[model samples]
Target: MSKSIKLLAMFGFVAAVAACTSGQTEEEYVVVNPEPISVEPTYTGKYK
Candidate 1:
């Protein structure tokens, strides 16, 4: 029917607009190594 054709055309137009606008990249990420932590030994006094 004519109504179905109009609805299909509208859907196609919307799909085309969405497809055109969805291909943008805005951000990028990079991975890096983390720093190591150092530990100090605990000293015990000469008491029981």
Candidate 2:
């Protein structure tokens, strides 16, 4: 392979690797549970 072509390929590989690994972090999660809730309906004069 030509020198310049090989160099470009290596640079591309390094750049791709760096981008893939730059933001490595721990995973995040959310836990939810069911709960009872009470609500009142609004009244209008038309209902009466």
Candidate 3:
């Protein structure tokens, strides 16, 4: 029983540390690169 309590406490401490450190310390920037406005044309016609 004592061992189980100690393990639980240790696990809780590790979880608390992880949660605290993961609080978004830096701002997240979403970089959006737009696709080209015009697409390349393909030739589908027969030439005489």
Q: What is the TM-score of each candidate against the true structure?
A: 0.51, 0.47, 0.52
RMSD of each: 5.9, 6.5, 6.3
Q: lDDT ranking from best to worst? A: 3, 1, 2
lDDT of 3 by residue, 1-48 (tens): 999999999999999999999896978799999999999978878872
What's the true lDDT of residue 25 in model 2?
65
Poorest stretch of ten by lDDT in candidate 3: 39-48
On residues 1-48, what C-alpha lDDT tens digit does candidate 2 reach at each position? Answer: 699999999999999999889779658899998675867677867857
**Alpha carbon lDDT of each predicted model:** 0.87, 0.87, 0.93
Error of 1 at 36 (Å): 12
Off by over 4 Å in 1: 29-48
TM match of model 3 to true structure: 0.52
Residue range with the least summed lDDT across 10 consecutive positions in model 2: 38-47
Candidate 1 overall Cα lDDT vs. reference?
A: 0.87
lDDT of 2: 0.87
Instruction: Give the Cα error of residue 11 in candidate 3, in Å.
Output: 0.4
- Angstrom error at residue 33, model 3: 14
